[model samples]
Target: MPLMHQLWLLVPWAVFALAAGVKFWRLTRPFRRQLAEPSTEQVRASLERRWRADQRELTE
Candidate 1:
């Protein structure tokens, strides 16, 4: 096959890859935001409460 034909074959694959990448980024956007943002004070307090409860259980 000619080089031009080979290059043409790659076009669809490239488009599909770009589309899939965009879809994946959109789907994971919320998770990415959570990772990027700092934990809020309320979340920190809730985690501390849970840790204290677990510690009490461990001591008993």
Candidate 2:
């Protein structure tokens, strides 16, 4: 693999790590939200997409 190609693998992990960090940080905060989660469909679709992509990475 090329040098840049190897870096591609690192990028996603970095992004996920950042996202998790942010989420966990949010959980520790005391902000009250006036909004509800959009919908089950949207949530499911996002999770499905994330799962599929992760699966493809592992399989490849």
The model with the greatest lDDT is: 1
Who wins the TM-score comparison?
1
Q: Give stretches of model 1 more than 4 Å off.
A: 39-44, 47-60
Error of 1 at 39 (Å): 4.8
lDDT of 1 by residue, 1-60 (tens): 999999999999999999999999999999998788576886899899999999999999
lDDT of each: 0.93, 0.87
What local lDDT does model 2 show for residue 25?
75
Clashes found in each candidate (C-alpha, N, C closer than 3 A): 0, 0
Question: TM-scores of all models?
Answer: 0.65, 0.46
Candidate 2 runs further than 4 Å off: 31-60
